[model samples]
Target: MSTTDYLTQGRRVLEIERAALATLEKNLDAQFSQACELMHYCQGRVVVTGMGKSGHIGGKIAATLASTGTPAFFVHPGEASHGDLGMITKQDVVLALSNSGETGEVVSIIPVLKRLNVPLIAMTGRPDSTLATLADVHVCVAVEEEACPLGLAPTASTTATLAMGDALAVSLLHARGFTADDFALSHPGGSLGKRLLLRVADIMHTGARIPMVPTGAITTDALLEMSRKGLGMTSIVDDNNKLLGIFTDGDLRRILDLRTDVHQTPIDQVMTAGCITATADMLAAEALQLMESRKINSLIVVDAQQQVIGAFNMHDILQSGVI
Candidate 1:
């Protein structure tokens, strides 16, 4: 096909799938609620099972459910009959996916699930099919047509199934009052997790590593501290260790025109007072925002008494992988 023909065909497929999702949304009723309620209250994992393309969607659904507060895992219907069925417990809920609602491998497990008294939640295109009839709750994911030209591929139907799965997962997430911190617990290795879970205290240089100079210290002393700490800035504090001001590379350049004596000038006299500061408990991502909004590269972490406790720069945030 020519480029235009290919583009047209791709658009047609997207349109069809989009329509399928709309239909799935409109058809949602009490059955969807029942399914969520069952999975939400499930004492054990939600065991997802299916065959072929449906199974692929089931795996993703299981993962989404697991990550979003609901404990769940996918079990291949074919393997379930052989021994994986043992993974399902009376305390667990079974979510079965089949477009026709009559996949043999999936249907074969209904009896075992029934015997174990496990709640069955079936997602299918046909409400009257065997799986739906036997399920404790039935969610119709019926699509008007497949996106494929031949209407033989599981295109729109699979998209509808996945969307329904997402809807259910998100609903459960809200019902459980799941928070970003809970999600970070499951995704700690990812960037989003780092952004949400990392605190300024975790990434900030603490103790002697912090670049700091006393209030009466000369500008030369501040410069020495900034160089030794390599943070491009130094926190100016009082005898009690309370923050007084800050001296940065920017201040040095600004004072150059006046030819101020770095050795004779008191650090507080040349330092930028009333500088923006952060708390150690503040989120690293929040600190990054403070830096960007203030157009500064470093932040001095202080305690409730405004005492200097730690310090961090943009490079520390970058190295922490919070960005």
Candidate 2:
């Protein structure tokens, strides 16, 4: 076949699947709402079960539900008939998937699910099929035709089922009042979690690591502290260790323009007082925003008493991966 022919076939397949999704959306009814309510009120985890292609989609649905504030896990129907059936409980809600609603492994386990008094939710193309008839809630995933030219592949049908599963998961997520912070807790190792949960204190330099100079220190002494700390700036503090001002590379440039004697000039006379500062508890992402907005590179972290407790720069955010 020519390349054009292959492209044409692929496009036809996508068009078929897209239509299938549209049909699924139109067919949604009260059953979808009832399914969401069941999963939302479930005191136990959602036990997702299926066979073959449906099983693959069920696994993805289980993962989506788990990450979005719904506790859920997938189990193979064949295995459930063996010993995994013990995993189901009366308190749990069971989500079973079968395109034909007649999958042997899935059909055989409805009795066990019933015995356990578990609420069964079924996803099937045929509403009159055994699985659908036995389920407490039936979500119709019917498709007019398969994307395969031969009309034997499970392409469009599976896509519709997966989309329906996603709709259920997302509806439950909102109904449970899931927040970004709650999502961050479940995804602590990901970039979104770092941006949401990581605070300035977690990455900022503190105590001796924070380069600081006394208010009366000479400009030359402040430069020494900035150089030793490698932050390109030194915070100015009073006798009680309260923040007074900040001296940065920009300050040095202005001092040079004025031809001031670095060895004799006090830092307080040349420093920028009451400069931009951050709290230790502020998010590192917020610190990055403050720095970007002010066109500055560093910020002094202060406490309730306005004492310099920590210091951070853009490089710190980059190193900590909160950027």
Candidate 3:
């Protein structure tokens, strides 16, 4: 085929799938709401099952549901018959996907599911098919046609099924009031979790590692502390460990321009008072935002009484993968 023909064919495929999704949107009725309600109230996991391409889509749906605060998992229908059916419990809800609703392996498990009294939610093109007829809730994922020119392959149907699954998951997610923090808890290893869930206390320097000096300490002494702590700045605190001010490398350069006697000048004389501070419980991502917004590289983490307890810099956030 010529390049133009190939491009035309690809566009046709996309257009067909787009139309299929549009049809799905119009067809959504009370049945979609009922499915969401069933999954929402399910005391146990949402067990997704299917065969072939539908199986792949079902697995993703199960994953999305699980990550979005819903407890869910995927079970292969073929394996369910080989003893995995024991995984299904009375408390769980079964989400069965079959465009035809008559895949032999999926259909064969209906009796067992029925015996276990697990609520069945079917996504299928045929509302009257055995799977749909037997399900407690039927989510019609019917597509006008396959994206394949020959109309043989599973294309548009699978897209529609996946979109329906997304719609169900998001609806249930909202109904449950699942927050970003809740999502981060489930995905602690993912970037979103690092940004939303990780706190300043989890990554900030503490104890002896925090660059700090007494308020009356000389500029030379504070610079020594900053060098030793390697944070580019030293927090000047009172005898009670309450933060008084901060002296940074930038301040040192400015003081040097004035030819200030570093050994004689008290660190507090050159320090920036009322500097921004963070709490240990504050999210590291929020700290990064503060740094970027204020054009500062470091922050002193304080207690409720404003005592310097921890410290962190831009490098800490980058190292912790919170950037």
lDDT of 1 by residue, 1-323 (tens): 99999999999999999999888878899999999999999999999999999999999999999999999999999999899988888999999999999999999999999999999999999999999999999999999999998988899999999999999999999999999999999999889899999999999999999999988898888888999999999999888999999999999999887899988999878999999999988999999999999999999999999999999999999999999
Give the alpha carbon lDDT tens digit for every residue of 6-61 in model 2.
99999999999999999999999999999999999999999998999999999999
Error of 2 at 92 (Å): 0.6
Residue 53 of candidate 1: its Cα lDDT?
Answer: 99
Error of 2 at 10 (Å): 3.1
Off by over 4 Å in 1: none
Instruction: State the local distance difference test value for candidate 2.
Output: 0.94
Best by TM-score: 1
| TM-score of candidate 1 relative to the true fold | 0.99
* RMSD of every prediction: 0.7, 1.8, 1.6
Error of 3 at 116 (Å): 2.4
- Which consecutive 10 residues in model 3 have the weakest lDDT in total? 184-193
Write candidate 3's Cα lDDT for 29-86 as tens digits.
Answer: 9989999989999999999999999999999999999999889999999999999999
Model 3: lDDT equals 0.94
Q: Rank the candidates by TM-score, best first.
A: 1, 3, 2
Residue pairs with backbone overlap in model 2: none
Better of 1 and 2 by TM-score: 1
